[model samples]
Target chain A: MTDHAPKDIDTLIELLAKLPGLGPRSARRAVLHMIRKRSILLTPLADQMQRVAETARECLNCGNVGTADVCDICANEARGNGILCVVEDVADLWAMERAAVFKGRYHVLGGTLSALDAVGPEELRIPQLVDRVTSENVTEVILALNATIDGQTTAHYIADQLEGRVTLTSLAQGVPIGGELDYLDEGTITAALNARRQI
Target chain B: MTDHAPKDIDTLIELLAKLPGLGPRSARRAVLHMIRKRSILLTPLADQMQRVAETARECLNCGNVGTADVCDICANEARGNGILCVVEDVADLWAMERAAVFKGRYHVLGGTLSALDAVGPEELRIPQLVDRVTSENVTEVILALNATIDGQTTAHYIADQLEGRVTLTSLAQGVPIGGELDYLDEGTITAALNARRQI
Candidate 1:
């Protein structure tokens, strides 16, 4: 509480600076904006954050976030019909969901296998994905990972592990090279999904 | 629910699909990811959302977001230097703060004076800004508004109103065309701030 740091603003700036692609400068701007839109964006966002902090949990079965364990998707009996789409991250999964296509379960890998980061299959949920394939009677596995080198590598590894156990497909070529699923438009994603090919 | 949404997965999918940039395919994928990352990303994200939902609020004075009525910045006696930096949005203000350059105070003008949206000064905090400038002994008014036509227009209007009463300046070059200050790098922002010329 010295003259150097304003406590609350400092805490907020630190938190904001940790967000992906945000530096100190951007964090400050974001904080200021949230302050201005407090009634609209800031308040709502904070409320959502608090609610999420309190009640949100990861589905024990899948990696999706929800208000409860096993998540709504994993709890749903209708979605257990053997189709599982695997993604690199939650944002990617969310992107796929935005398309309003695909009627299947999901498995989030948390992140792709990065050689630079020393992320192997074990670091990811690859082992869990393999176990789920056998337990869920899955007929198809859609490798909907991103198009990055790491994403492709992770997808290939998953495909290898599930070889011959079930049908495997990946999203078609509408996704640009090095592009993340999170950045793609719904129409592009939809087109890619509709034209998916067997890997 | 019927076969159309016989499972919580479907319900979850419907909800997730409605998120920004997410579609049905991505929603299902995201839901799955959250389920798997229950203890990590999903749980934390949900909890954060909940927390933010409950505790977030606007700063009564500067329109910054915080748990209290007056944001941390607004309530701080040290930040009250009678020098108000006006910005189009909180994001811009946050950017300035991130640079840790300015120590005065802030006035977030929710948005620019947009003729297309029929937004006027009354619709924004322009009047509040003017009041703060006069009452706060503001030696200088930095118009850190965006580079957009509307942003510049708003800056010009404020400048004209203040006229000879205060030293007026705008963020200098290095800010890309139509670029929001929030998106600029810290060094670039610093350079721009250092090079700022009179408006």
Candidate 2:
């Protein structure tokens, strides 16, 4: 800052810069743009941010964020019929929801099992997930964790915990949609080939 | 959004998405990050934004944004002792101040001359700049606009208007600091060679 910059504007820039994918330069640009559009963007954005700060909370059962004590997904009985999608984070849960492919409820583990980080079954929402499976009468649980090593380890851990108790499945590994074979990695290509099926 | 997203959170995301260098995906991630860090970041940021929205205003003299009617650079009598740096926008003026090389005042033009956009001298702070040259005993004016076509055109227009009244200068065109010849374009290399001095 020039020291001539108002303290409030400078502070806003610093906090905004802390956000993911934004650095100091982009944050300054964002602040300038906000100052220029005070009514349409800045004031309303401030109001909304304050409102979210006051009300946003993690779902009691699934760890998903929402305004209520229980997230909409967990509260809706229609969504909790049978299948339960298990994910590594709320971000993954939102992504699955965005695709609109999954009709069942979700369980966010918060994080994966990591020995270095001292994260274990008790650290995540695993116990809550198990309770939900039995208490909510879930018939099938899909391990939709990421393809990372830690993610797979967590998936296996959950599978062991729920084995024989209910039907369990994992998302199929294959070439992604719109992916070109020429640009595909060897592991993905191999997986796609190994899991090839009749159309 | 899955419609499960709280209205305030979604509204905040939408407003944030309108900012430069952010899109829908990044905005979603930023909102999630903000919600996670509510006390330290989200609440404080909201407060600061509201403060800026209520207090920040453009300095009537130079078009520089500050919390007062006249910006610090314009109000300080010590900074008015001759040289004036003319910038295309408030961002450029702030950049100049951050460098701390200039010990004079600044005049923000608001924007450069644009034919298609029908922007003329009156649309910017050009008239006020000319008035300051005479009223404030300015001896020199530095056109610190960007190296864009409109910027240069605006610089030349201002130079013609203030010719013979005060010394007019433009930033030198050449390789930028830390720039390498191997990575430089031909035009910059040519400009550097043309402006080469005996070392």
Badly placed stretches (over 4 Å) of model 1 are: A1-199, B1-32, B174-199
All candidates' TM-scores? 0.55, 0.97
lDDT tens readout by residue for model 1, B1-199: 1223224445545543543445566555554555554555444554454455456666778865567888778778998887788877666665677688998888878888888899998877878877887788888888888777788799888898889888988766677779898888887798778877898
- Tens-digit lDDT track for model 2 on B1-199? 4434777787888888999999988998898899889999999989989999999999998889999999878888889879999998877887888888899889999889998999999998799899999999999999998988899899999999999999999888999999989999998899899999898
Give per-residue CA lDDT, model 2, range A39-131, as digits (tens). Answer: 998998888889999999999888899988998888888897799999987778878987898999999888899999999899898988899
Number of residue pairs clashing in candidate 1, backbone atoms closer than 3 angstroms, sequence gap of 3 or more or interchain: 73
Residue B11 lDDT (model 1): 58
